[model samples]
Target: MKLPKALAFDVFGTVVDWRTGIAEQAAAFLARYMPGTDPGAFADDWRNLYQPAMEECRSGRRPFRLLDALHLETLVQLLERRGIGTAAIGEGELLDLAYAWRRLRPWPDVPPGLAQLRKLFPVVTLSNANIALMIAMNRFNGLEWDAILGAEVSRSYKPTPQAYLASAAALCLDPQDLCLVACHHSDLAAARACGLQTAYVDRPMEYGGARAPDGSYEQAWEWRAGDLLELVRVFTSH
Candidate 1:
């Protein structure tokens, strides 16, 4: 495979353990706000709303909103379904809960692996996360990124051609010159369709093992690896 000019990453499940991070933060919030709630289940429930919320914007049913906004909206909905009214929680508290996304813990391989990858090519985020949230995660995780470009810059969500094309454009490279690294095959398929190279990185525990790992693809990709470190090895080997 030809070397890519830049490596665009899908941040959430690919780089960080969002489920664990959200559950950890939710535990404290739930203890005080809604005692006896199962934080892990709560985290899963909140995450289950992710795609449908983005689909609203993706389908043009609503104007594009930041992931932060969508997260807050979903959190409110989740809480309401539990019989907790918005009036029961202060806006400050709600915003703090939403900010949990910004403080996610990186997968064990991510920080060092990304540092190694950056030496070879410009490594930037191609995530649905907004710039501000990405900034916070970068700081929180000590991640080194060449740039942060994705849905916010593209004004569209992943699986949409615009998100992939716009992210490549942000780096002043042809879509084929950027390799999208993601755990989700659907995201990689979308990038491939947009003329970008694709790398499938296995993240078996992304959903905390609730779902089966999707290592299979309809067709071979430019690369595949078990983790970011393995991806670095693949690049160097090529």
Candidate 2:
């Protein structure tokens, strides 16, 4: 396979371990705000609302909202469902908790893999995370990027062609000259449909120890590997 000039990554589960970060933070928050509840379950609950909230904007059911806003909305609903008073949680801490997505830790393999890939090709993030949130993650985790381009830049979400095209355009590259590397098959499929190349990196722990990812190298994709380090082996050899 010919190498592309640039690579765009899916940030959340693909680049960082959101489940662990969210669960730990949620546990700390719950210890103070609500006692004896399971933080890991709460993390899953918050994430479960992620796609549906974005779909509201993607389908035009609501005006475009940043991913931060969607995370807040879902957090509020979870609070209410748990019988915790949203007002009692207070506005400031509530906002901070919602933005916890910005503070996720990278997978153990991310730093070395991204560093190697950056040497091989221009690497930027292509994610549903809003720009501010993505930047915070970059700073928090020290994941250097050549550029950050995603839903905020395009005013669209993943699985939407506009987002992928906008990301490639931001780098002054054609769709085929950019590859979308992600843990989610749906995201890669969308990028493929938009004429961008696709690479699948398995993240079995993305859902924490409770669940496993759905796809394997057995599926048809332009590239498949255990992790980003393995991808480095592929592109660097070419």
Candidate 3:
């Protein structure tokens, strides 16, 4: 099948190594602020809260909140749970730590693949990350993006049709004209349900290879590749 006119990517695990990036930042911050915390496990714990936090809004338990605000709230709760009181960690320190999400390192293939992919299609993000967070990460990591369109734009998180549909609307394209490139099956499945094309990028090490992907790739998808470079090749070759 021919590719779509625009590509919207899932930024977290698809484009960047969040685990290592968060662990590194947490290590640097906690070493000076709160000693004896395992940085890697700490990173995992923080990420572990991502879905449920978003679910609060998704389930309509709370109004739409930016990922940045969720991150801050989660961090404060985590610190207190670890017995690191607010007095021990000031507001400035908490804010700095929460902003670590903006400093993630890209997967090795990301920059080159995105640079090449941009030549063929209008490439933008469809992440749950807020607009400011996305912009900061792109500038910090030197990613090539035509626009940032995602949860913040729609005020709706992924798997919700609004997030995907809103992204297409932002670019003034039909949902069918846009492809959602992601490492998570649930993400692509949701996009497919909304009539958008799906491209799966295999990131076996997204969770440090500790867990397998949700299922086999037996279902039909527009494209699947081992990495972004491979996805770029698939697009260019067809």
Candidate 4:
């Protein structure tokens, strides 16, 4: 089947590897700020803080916080836990490092796959990544988005009706006229429920885990492909 007029992607894991990206950046920052520190190890430790930080809010220990804020909080906590001093870290200076997310190296085939798809559809993003993050990502890394829609615009998180519609509206198309492509099944399910076409691109490393994506993920999506490259073939072939 031909893809819809717009292709909306889930940013974090779908577009870039946040865990790996942040970890690498963490190592570099820690090295600069605290020499003799093993940044790789620090990075790994820092990554471990992401999910729990979000879950605390999701589980009601804290209220909803944007992903950016959560990352900052997690970084700060991890820095303390690591015995690294934070006197050098300035207000929002470290958070600004989130530009790392924007500069993340595109998945092996992402740039090319997007190139192919853009021939047929206007490419865009629908992600939890903040607006400044997305804009800087484009400026630094050549992400050729016609427009970028993030939770910052809708002031709500993904899988919400509003997030999906934010992309649809930004594209100036109806939900069905847009396609939401993500590695996570939940994002696709919510987009589908909102009347958008769905594509699930498998990024098994999204969680930095070895186990296969659960059986439920196999059940939730309309189309599944190994990655964005394969997805291009799958979508355009039919």
Candidate 5:
């Protein structure tokens, strides 16, 4: 198989451990306000709203908004359902909680593995995350990237053709020359449909192993690895 000219990563679950990071912050925030709430459960519920929130923008039912805004909107809704209102939790505190997305920790293998992979191909993030949040995550996690390209750049979310295609275009590469590396099959499937190459990186703990991860795909992708390190091995061996 031909090697890709560049590699595009899906950041939220694939590169960073969003669930754990969010849970840690949520735990702190909840302890102060909603003392009895389960932070992990709260994190899960917050994440559950991710797709539907983006779907509104993806379907053109709403104009494009940054993930940060979408996150805050959902967080407010979640809090209200639990009998907490914006008046109870001031806007500044709410903003802090919403900004927790910017401080996620990377998966254990991510830093070194990504460093090695960068030696072989240009690696850039193609995530739904807005630029400021991505920048914060990179700084917080010591992740060095060639570029950040995704929803904010494309003005569209993943599973939408524009998100993948625009990222490749931004890199001055053809869709086929850029391989999308993601933990989600649905993400890879979407990239594949848009003419980009695909690599599946298994992230079984993405959801804290609450159930099986979204690891299944109908057709084989161009590459599959247990993690970024394994993908590095695949590239070097070839």
Candidate 6:
């Protein structure tokens, strides 16, 4: 495959461990608000809402929304279910917690791998997460992206053609000239459909409490790596 001019990352599952990050933040929030809630179990419960929440939009039961909005709603519902009464929390707090994703910890290899890749490619985030969230995340996580981009600009999230096309167009590159690097096959498949090259980075611990289902790493990826640093080495021949 030809070298790509831009490297677009799938933020949530690929770059950061959203499950662990959300769980850790939820534990802190619960300790502060609800008090005594298990960050681990609470995290599992909170994440359970993720797919169903998106299904609501994809199924047309609700209109499409940015991932941030979906995440807040999920958190609120989780708070209530964990015996965390709604009156105990405020919308401001929910919003703040949603912003917690911006500060999420990168997988062990992310920062260093990015440092290596940045020297060879213009790195940017192509995520379902919104701009404010992405910017806050950049500062929080010490990410060094040359640019932050998202479905916020396209007004649609991943698996949507508009989102992928909009990213390449926004970056002023042909789809084939850009590579979408992500752990999720769903995301990279979308990029492939949009005419981009693809690389699959493994984040086997994205689910936090459990490993990703077996064979998830063996999808129809053009290139696969154990981590981002390995990916950079594979791409740059360094």
Sort all candidates by TM-score, best to worst.
Answer: 5, 1, 2, 3, 6, 4
| Weakest lDDT window of 10 consecutive positions for candidate 4 | 210-219
State each model's CA lDDT, in order.
Answer: 0.91, 0.88, 0.89, 0.73, 0.91, 0.81
Pairs clashing within candidate 6: 102-137
For candidate 2, what is the TM-score? 0.95
Off by over 4 Å in 3: 216-218
- Among these predicted structures, which one has the highest TM-score? 5
lDDT of 5 at 185: 90
True-structure RMSD for candidate 2: 1.7
As for candidate 2, its clashing pairs are none
Clashing pairs in 5: none
Model 3 worst lDDT window (10 residues): 210-219
lDDT, model 6:
0.81
- lDDT of candidate 2 over 1-238, digit per residue (tens): 6788899999989999998899887887899877887888788889888888999999999999999999999999888888888877779999989989999999999999999999999999898988899888888988999988899999999889999999999898999999999998878878888999888998888887565444442348888889999999987776
- In Å, residue 33's CA in model 1 sits off its true spot by 3.3
RMSD vs true structure, all candidates: 1.5, 1.7, 1.7, 3.5, 1.2, 2.5
User: Once all C-alphas are superposed, what RMSD does model 3 give against the true structure?
Assistant: 1.7
TM-score against native, each model: 0.96, 0.95, 0.94, 0.79, 0.96, 0.87
Stretches of candidate 2 above 4 Å error? 212-218
Tens-place lDDT per residue, model 5, 1-238, is: 7999999999988999888899999898898888988888899999988999999999989999999999999999888888887787778989999999999998999998999999999999999999998888788889999999999999999989999999999999999999999988989989999999999898888888866445465359999899999999998887
Q: In model 2, where is the ten-residue run with the lowest total lDDT?
A: 210-219
Can you write out model 6's per-residue Cα lDDT over 186-209, one digit (the tens) per residue?
777778988998999877677764
Q: Give the TM-score of candidate 4.
A: 0.79
